[model samples]
Target: MTELPDTRLFDTVLVANRGEIACRVIRTLRARGIRSVAVYSEADAGARHVREADQALCIGPAAAAESYLNIAAVIGAARASDAQAVHPGYGFLSENLEFAKALEAAGITFIGPNIEALNVMGDKIRSKNHVAAAGVPVVPGISEPGLTDADLIAAAADIGYPLLIKPSAGGGGKGMHSVFAAEELPATLATARRVAAASFGDDTLFLERLVANPRHIEVQILGDTFGNVIHLGERECSLQRRHQKVIEEAPSPLLSGLDDGGAVRARIGAAACAAAASVNYTGAGTVEFLVSDDTPDEFFFMEMNTRLQVEHPVTEMVARVRGKSLDLVEWQLRIAAGEKIDFTQQDVTLEGHAVEARVYAESPAEGFLPATGTVVVLEESVAQRPGVRVDSSLARRLKITANYDPMLAKVIAWGTDRREALDRLDAALADYVVLGVPTNVEYLRLLVADPDVQAGRLDTNMIERKLPDMAFRTVDAGDYAAAALAARKVDVARPNAPGEAPAASSWGRLDGWRLGDPAPWRSAWAAPGRTGVVTVSGPQADSGTEGPGVVHVNGIGGDQESRTALDLNGTTGGELLWDGQERGYRVGMLGETVFLGSGGWSVALERLDREAATARMLAGLEREDAAADPQLRSPMPGTVTVVNAKTGDRVAAGDVLLAVEAMKMEHQITATMAGTVHIGVAVGALVKADQVVATVEPDEDNSTTIPEGE
Candidate 1:
């Protein structure tokens, strides 16, 4: 064990990122009594991270290019606040070699591995070359620098069919594509290049043989300036979507076999430590690998993330630092300050099983499409036991925009065994509630509860394979009643608030009530964007028992009516109770949007007029005017910065109609059906969610559907 330094690493630190990871680092800084500074973009003017920090500065607008990625602005903010160190929390500038160089030149500590390791390991291709030369087993691929499209295609042919194209400059599945056939290469290559350039400013790419159904295993390591390094075991991160991990567990379940006792785990850990030592790496970093299913003993070096991983909690939960409450961020801070790690590899030990589930704001059922909306209600369950931890940046009134990754919260659970840890994780997932936008919580619930996941019969493609069987859990009539009742309760509670269009007296009055008489007023209430009204009936606010009572919700999409009876009379203080069910609920409402939540599962309902919901449903079914071209709308709010398709441009389904920039990420509005396009917006036009940006003529036979330039 090396000795400690007398001087503190940094008295004040500036976090050069936003969202949950920023807040996550701030937690340790606060615990250590270190003053923290935060930088935010215009979109995150009121972000939770901004409020949590001791001080904050605005860098640029919503786009990350002008803000979080704007190295100069971040440095200026840090200097202005007199911060001694900068923590790039897991994204944005976390892995940028230039950022580290800039911070070093500016005489401010960069709380990560030094610039040398970042340069060598940050570039995927270069890292592979370096590690393989150091005797690490790497995946078979073509990684020649400056390869042309033809050269890449020829290399792909040599690598055989079912190759993967990945951006050399970035990870997190961005700009990564799987080419299963020769025909898919051209388009896949084009899209990959575009995404790579947009995401990392460098479109340098590499090709690799696609390891089918391989389990993703990554080892966490901590190193210090004194050449001492330690491994914190491995995390099973096989479950992924589009190459990004969704769920992660420590002490990899996949590595457990009947006869092999810890040999494979030891080999992988030593390989990881060797990989780190080869780079002379310091601070917290993750070395990732892809182990083939058939040959469980063999593992190939995938890539090394030279920053704290998003799933670090799973490793932290399992591996406890003796005699310290320190986490990875703290270790990074100490290591950056030239402090030696007090413990060696022999001091570290994996205690028990732990699991982490990433609860994203995106909908898994809808092609895992990114959805953005205001968080109307955010409720987190307190983990009384040591097993549960939720790392999140969500707060009520927080707006989840499309300009960034759609991850909302992470639910982590630790237990004495795998089954107990899984049970705790499932309970935590059920208790995590988020509303006002679609989420993958329910899907995640079904996923963990699946037998294959429990048995650890998993791979990268398991989620995709099980998705068809895991269509979103059916919403019961009682669920509908609860959501509707909650939404209506909000509407009835607020009468004088602005932006609320007053409803007509006929629809507003309680059924069975006239002037000065007690009557049960019945009015039709509709679920937003659906067909039938629940026909909710309750007393007026001024009446004795002024609240929603019995709701006679009609059956959904069938002849059967009155699906469930709900006694929503006293569903207040954020709770709802149905007549038949025994499960108690907590409810929250924002304007007409209500989030009914309980046990970590939540659903959002919009209070809609019976006529409006019916009208919307009819419009979808009856594209009656075949001649009238359908309009393309922005599904999420953002500024229209690019319109690719012009009028009369023929396009197939999924063609980019336009690109909207929100929360620093570009959400391309693509065509749902094949058609000729008539773009409505120009570059630099700010657009709202669902605002019409273009129109498409679906009738292939009709060329004259769109007027010329008018």
Candidate 2:
């Protein structure tokens, strides 16, 4: 066991980050009795992390570069807060050498690797060269960051088709693109360069051979200043979308062959340690690898993240000794305080299997496009649940802006084995709910139950191959009828028998009025996306929103009609006895949307007036069509960085016309048809979601099909 090398523990610590990661570190600091300081941008003034920290400071405005990524601003905040050390979370300056050096110059501690270690591992090209010199295998490719685009094109020819263009400065799947042909290199290259520059402040790029149908495995590395280093086991991160990890699991299933103590795990573990020790790494870091299923014993280095990873929970769960997982952030603090690791490799042992699913605010049906809205209601929590944990940044009424990453939270579950863990994870995901924004929750629910995932047959290409078959569950005709019934039942106050005349409006309301037999109180409602009519008739007097009443519901689209007894207690839940089973759901009214939430499903119903709904729908259709016409709107909110095409400039389809940036990632705007361009927004101007940035007047003479701009 290594002893304490020095005694200089920080009394106050500042976390130079935001969101769930900052909250996570604050929790550790609280446990250690260390004063916690948090910094936030204007966009996150009242965010959860700010409220949780012991002290809060405003760094800058909304944009990340002006706030979190501003080294000077972060250091200034640290100094103002009187923090002795600063912990940079997974992203945003976590691996920045300049930030560490600045802290060092100011006599402040940066809780990561040393400057030389960061300089070596932070650069993908340099790290590859350094680790390869220590007898570690790397993906074969050209990695010269100084190469020109033409030179890169030449390099691609020798490397052959089906390679990847990657930024040399950062990972986390940002600015990484796969090329399938020689002709696609230039456009993909330009995109990678722009994204890399915007994301990592470095546009230098390189070419790496793409490993097809490979499993993503990463080892956790920890070291101290006394030259003692050890490695935790590997985590499986093969489930990915657009090169970003979506779901991760510990104890890769491929290592099942080596469960009886084979050399495979030991070999990979030693390699990761060697890679870390080569640069004298300190604190927590992760070394990612891509291993082929055909030869699980052989693997190639992908990249090493020089900071704590987003998937650290799974590793922590597997590495837990007692009821609590090891305080990795505490270890980070100790190492930063010049303390050495107190335990050897033999002290660490595997406990149980754990799986983590990253939940993002996106619509899977729309190609997983990011979405933003206020969270009306949130019921996700893992506090009371056993073997389940949720790390999130969500609060009721919290508006999710399009200014940062789309990831909302992570749900994790641990069990005695893989099946139990996955099953628990599925139930936990279903238990999680969010309203007022489109999310991939339902899509994730379906994914955990997939046959291949259940059988542990996973690869980086799993989601891409099964995407066409996946869909988001929507409310059906029955749900609409139930919604209409519930709506009318709760709105009536005066009682009228089944054959009595309909009640007139007490005040100035014209809703819930009818003039026919069997008409007690009639109302019409419509589902959001479906064009149909649903009507409900109920007893007039359902006092206090609950009474014994016979309700008749009908839907015109499917000719669905039903008569049943319903107890509508305003927002309180009722039961529906249908098709041999009784289903219970809680009914809540949110403006026009009616939410029927239950165990495993939630359906939203939009209240509609027959006349107004029809007119407004027609108007909405007109507005949508006009919005999609010649006007080219920005898909997301961002600042316009460059406008390439001018008014009256004739351009072919797919020509880059403008570029907008958000969260430091640049998005290019292209012409949909061969046409003359009419630019709307100028460079350096700020634009909101769906704001018109340009217009493309389609050239009638061209015969080639025009693709729509995203």
Question: Which candidate should be chosen as best, given TM-score against the real structure?
Answer: 1
Ten-residue stretch with the least lDDT total in model 2: 540-549
lDDT of 2 by residue, 1-710 (tens): 12223454778999999888998999888877789999999999978889999999999998888999999999999999999999998898899889999999999999999998999998999999899999989988998759889989998888887898989987888889999998889999997897788677799999988887789999998999999989878899999987889899998877864554347888888899999999999999999898987778888888889899999988878885333467678788898888878777777767779999988877676566667776765777654578898888888777788778888888999888998899889889877877666677777888888999999899998999999997656666556655665665555443655666555533323243345433455455655445446544444222224333344444434555555444554445677643334556656666666666655355566777678767756855875664235567887777898889899998877788998876434677887677788999898898897898888787766554344654
Q: How accurate locally, in lDDT, is each candidate?
A: 0.77, 0.78
User: How well is each residue in 1-710 modelled by candidate 1, as lDDT tens digits?
Assistant: 12235665678999998888999999988977889999999999989999999999999998788999999999999899999999998888999998999998999989999888999998899999999988889999998678777789888878997898999988888888888999899888988888798778889888999997699999999888888878988999999876878899988987865258388888888989889989899999999999988788889999999999999998888886563333778788888878778876666777879999988877565456567878876667545556799898888889888777778778899988899999998887776777777788878888899999999888998888888877564445566666665554544544544543444454453223356634433333344334334545445223323253555555455422332333343543333345544445666666666566665556565666667666666784675544343777775666776677788998866666778765434577776566777888898787886688887768556444432111
Clashes of each: 15, 1
Clashing pairs in 2: 495-541
Please estimate how well model 1 matches the true structure, expressed as its whole-model Cα lDDT.
0.77
Per-prediction TM-score to the true structure, in the order listed: 0.89, 0.87
